[model samples]
Structure formats: C-alpha cells, structure tokens
Target: MLYKVLEVPGIEYIVLDFKSSDGNFIAQDLDDSETWNAKAFYQWLIDEVLVFTDDGISGMDKDLYKQFKAFANQRGVCVCDSRKI
Candidate 1:
C-alpha cells in the first residue's frame, strides 16, 4: 500500500490514502505509536487497520482487539516509545 509518515507536534502517524471509486482521495490516520519495524507495522496494518476499521477509527472484534496488545508486545511495538531519542 502507498502511504506517508507524518510527524506532528507530539505524535507520528501513518497516512493511508485511498482513492474512492468516484475519484476522491481520502486520507486516513493510523497512529504510529513510534513503531519503526516493517513487519510489526505490517501486523499493525492487519490487526489495527484492516481488522479494526478501514478508516482506522472504529470498533474491532473484542477478542481480536484484546489479542493485539500481546501481539504488539511480542513484536516490540512500544520499544521506541520510552527511548530518549
């Protein structure tokens, strides 16, 4: 998928731009949570974006959502968050 990474004041986000069938391009934000791994980010795309909500801002299956934390943990998703950078 084609996307862009943006850094705002206190947050970094991934922008997923989808062109609608009618030719309108809509951008969706997926909070990066500071993860920089391609594999982990791919999983985030599956677990957080695709599984939860296409727009990245809606409900997810409870069981699936609950498992994401553990999944993310195993992938070291939050490793960079507490770093001094």
Candidate 2:
C-alpha cells in the first residue's frame, strides 16, 4: 500500500493509496478528501502545501507509527510510540 501525509490549515491527514479488489486505483484521505487522486498526490505531498503532524498520527493501513517516527525525525516533529503515550 502507498501512503502519504497531508495537512490543510489546522488539520493534518494521512492518505492511503491502494487498488480496489476490482482492479481500480482508489484513494482514501484519512481526514476526508472526496476529490484527491493518485495522479497528483505525490506532488501535493512534496509541495509542503500540507504539513506533517506534530501531535499524533493516524492511518492504520500502513505502519504509520514507524513511518511517522522517521518523518518526525527529519522535520523535527516529536512523535512518541502510542503504546507508551
């Protein structure tokens, strides 16, 4: 499964990009985007139009905890293991 992090204003989101059982590409924005597609998803994530999470993480489809831990390191966003929080 492909994964991405996004944010708009006061909200942060995690986007899960995957294929449906019917063989069609599907995108689900964790915080809810009814119009996002895989076509420009990467660009959106890279543009910094969305910021990384600094509080908590979402999206269980991917190993989001581990993924965000690394992401937080690079961006200086502190993230702790949920089990310990």
Candidate 3:
C-alpha cells in the first residue's frame, strides 16, 4: 500500500524528489508549483482522484480509513474508501 499525507497552506507534508506521498509535491521542478496549481489539484482530488494503490491495497486498513473518512466528511473533504484499488 502507498500512504501519503497532504498538507495545506499552514501545514508541512512529506517531501519527495520525483514520486511522492506529500500533497502538492512536484515531480519535476521542485518549486514549479504554479503548473500544479492547488485549486485544480484539489478539484481533481475530490472529483477524480482516490487513495488507490496498484497492489490493490487502498483503504485496506478499515478502522483507520473509516475514522479519517468520518473526519473528512465532517469537514467536507473527500475521502473515498469504497473498495480496494
């Protein structure tokens, strides 16, 4: 399973060089965030993206996922755990 943390403006997320677990991380130019504008990214996250893993490990940890999903749901953030990837 691939796990990641996404930080908003005031928070700090995990950093990566190419691939990443941090939200808003750049795959190319580390500072070239303008290309990966957050609004569009978040929109895609809510509408299209999901916490999926190629090994079909997404949302496998049910208790934790459910707690986080509940938290996100309360805050109106999108957190999907409908099935395995």
Candidate 4:
C-alpha cells in the first residue's frame, strides 16, 4: 500500500528545538501561560483550524512544533502578518 501526505504550497516545513522557563522538558507546552490568554490562543487555534481545514491543517500530528508549523502554513494561506508574528 502507498501512503500519501499533503502539504501547503510554498510552506516550508520547520523543525527546531525550543525551550521554556521552569523546565517544560518533562511536560507542558512551550507557550507562555503567564500573562497570556491560553484560552484565547486555544480558541484562536480552533477558529483558524476550521478555516484552514480545506488546506493542510487537518489530521496533522499535534506534537510539539509540528502542529504549529502546519497551523502556520494554513494560517499563511489567509493571513501574512500573523505568520510573521
């Protein structure tokens, strides 16, 4: 059997290690929960994910930076500045 994968055009796949204070290496996400609306960010992801469903955002593994890259690529489809930010 052959397995096929899809990705957004011109979307560069990125893989890199990032760190968070208080030692998230054991558990927890890289996002800064302090002084940031985790709920809003989560909701933003949900909202954007729905819009980018036709692109290449669905079924992508939500592990570490992989999901964000896909999300970024999907977001890249609609918004330019947010991808940079």
Candidate 5:
C-alpha cells in the first residue's frame, strides 16, 4: 500500500490519497481518511509535521507542540492522534 498527503486550494482541510483494494486511487480529506493495516494519515502528520516523543511515554515537545497547536488552530484542523474521536 502507498499513502500521499496533499493540500488543495479552497479546501479547509488537508487531502490524502491512497490506493483501494481494487487498485483504484481514492482521495479524501484528512479528517475523513480511513486507516488500514495500522497505517493512517495521522502517522504522516506526526512523523512529518509534529514533534513527538517516542520513548514509550506520553510526552510532547513543548515548543513544537505550541507551533503545531497554532498551525492547527489557524487551519481549523485537529491535532495529530491515532484516533480523531
């Protein structure tokens, strides 16, 4: 499987592209994207956009967190997480 993150003009949220089971490409807004095989768009957000600690503890990089919060607020999107709900 492959994943891609995209930004479309006139859209409030980011966009995502991935392959479906039928080998067709599907596009959806970030908040509405699906998770398959434990891989999701939020993983890209965490790995690329946000700074997080991976030492088996629930810790955040304060400065990066602040920046991310501001960015999310400005864009009207939620912060990165495994589950959006």
Candidate 6:
C-alpha cells in the first residue's frame, strides 16, 4: 500500500494506492477534481470512487476500506456511505 497527500493553494486530499495479486485499488475523488477537506474527500472516496453495490459490496478490499474509515474517523471525518441511508 502506498499513499500520497496532495496539497494545493486551498485544497488538500489524500490518494491511497493499494496493490495486490488480485488488482490495484486507488482511492481518490472521481466525480470532481477539487477537494477541500478530509471529510469531503473521504466521503466522496467512499460514495463515488468506491461505488458500493446495492448489496453493500465494493471492489475494494474490505480491510483496506475499514482502515480508511478508521483513519478518517480519527481526523473527525465521517466516511459513512450516504447512499445506504
């Protein structure tokens, strides 16, 4: 797993790249190119990038996503899937 923090003038976001024998998982904001905070970034990462199925399944690794959620929570960011509600 490799990650990078992108910081610009007024925007900041983290890009997480996880590689495994199955495939590569890259977490980022896919809908929009701009991000402002960890909350929004993680929210979008889960909602848009992960794109959970109706059965609550995503292509990403479950453990990795769990770690991402924990990291976001530590930073006061809610990475809950809005579409599930």
Alpha-carbon local distance difference test for all models:
0.39, 0.43, 0.40, 0.33, 0.39, 0.50
Candidate 1 lDDT, 6-78, residue by residue in tens: 2211223555333446423333446533533444464445444442334322344444444544544554554
RMSD of 3: 9.9
lDDT of 6 by residue, 1-85 (tens): 1242122111244554445343334455445654335455555555555555553335545666566667767656676666766
Best by TM-score: 6
lDDT for model 6, please: 0.50
- Give lDDT tens digits, candidate 5, residues 1-85: 1121121112345433434564333335567664322133334454454333433113443554566455444444455553333
RMSD of each: 12.2, 10.3, 9.9, 12.0, 12.6, 10.5
The TM-score of candidate 5 is: 0.29
**Distance from true position, residue 31, model 6, in Å?**
11
Model 6 — TM-score against the truth? 0.47
Estimate TM-scores for all models. Answer: 0.29, 0.30, 0.31, 0.23, 0.29, 0.47
lDDT score for residue 10 of model 1? 26
lDDT of 5 at 12: 42
Tens digits of per-residue lDDT, candidate 2, 1-85, equal 2333433233345545455563334445565555455434433443434333444443332465467455444544444443354
Candidate 5 has its poorest 10 consecutive residues by lDDT at 1-10
Candidate 4 lDDT over residue span 14-67, tens digit each: 222225463222212235322323233334444533223444344543352355
Pick by lDDT: which candidate is best?
Answer: 6
Distance (Å) between predicted and true CA of 57, model 1?
6.2
Point out the higher-scoring one by TM-score: 5 or 6.
6
Give the residue spans of candidate 4 off by over 4 A.
Answer: 1-36, 50-59, 62-85
Runs off by more than 4 Å, candidate 1: 1-39, 42-57, 79-85
How accurate locally is residue 41 in candidate 6, as Cα lDDT from 0 to 100? Answer: 53
